[model samples]
Target: MEEESWQSITVMEDKNGEPHVLQQKVKVYTSGVSEESPGYTKPLMKHRIVPVKDIVNL
Candidate 1:
């Protein structure tokens, strides 16, 4: 089965020129004999959205 883990993220940006997390999804899989193959358990997901209030020039 596939190992349960979090997805790696370096940087995330939104359409309003803001950094945020929206509709985060993760895949949970059942254990298998090998790492190559794994079974899915269910579709687990989440959602979030944020807007930039101000922009600062650096």
Candidate 2:
């Protein structure tokens, strides 16, 4: 399972339109059932900062 969080910040406006910066946080959960043994593992988390336009274009 995965979870996500987002925050937006107004960085600047270009001739086209207003641009925004985004702060994104992601959490990934996995079952710790490996060859070694079945165990409990902490969730993995990641953070990223990107431009809104870049995502929109993609």
Candidate 3:
């Protein structure tokens, strides 16, 4: 099971006409079928994505 968290990708258009994507904090969940592992019920680390709107405050 691959848990993909959707996040807002900010972009800054430069004069060179290149879209530079900001490297924001994102939750990378490396999870798979529990049955396959047969031991770990949850992921090794619990990470949550930080929303762009809320990221400004915190």
> Model 1 over residues 1-58: C-alpha lDDT tens digits?
4544433333468665666433334566866666666566444564344332332234
Per-residue CA lDDT of candidate 2, range 1-58, in tens? 3334454433655566756564535343445454455433333354455656676874
* CA RMSD, predictions in order: 7.6, 8.3, 10.6
Model 1, C-alpha of 51: deviation from truth (Å): 12
Clashes of each: 3, 0, 2
Residue 54 alpha-carbon offset, candidate 2, angstroms? 0.7
Q: What clash count does candidate 3 reach?
A: 2
Q: Top model by lDDT, which number?
A: 2
Please provide the root mean square deviation of candidate 1 (C-alpha atoms, Å).
Answer: 7.6
Candidate 2, residue 16: Cα displacement in angstroms equals 11
Q: What would the TM-score be for candidate 3 when compared with the true structure?
A: 0.26
lDDT of 1 at 25: 45
Greater-TM-score candidate between 2 and 3: 2
Runs in model 2 lying further than 4 Å from the true structure: 1-17, 30-47
lDDT of each: 0.48, 0.49, 0.43
Question: Least lDDT summed over 10 consecutive residues: which range in candidate 3?
Answer: 38-47
Candidate 3 Cα misplacement greater than 4 A, ranges: 1-8, 34-58
Per-residue accuracy of model 3 over 1-58 as CA lDDT, tens digit each: 4443434445555566654444433444444555355332222333343434444543
Q: After superposition, how far is residue 56 of candidate 2 from its true place, in Å?
A: 1.3
Off by over 4 Å in 1: 1-3, 6-16, 19-27, 48-58
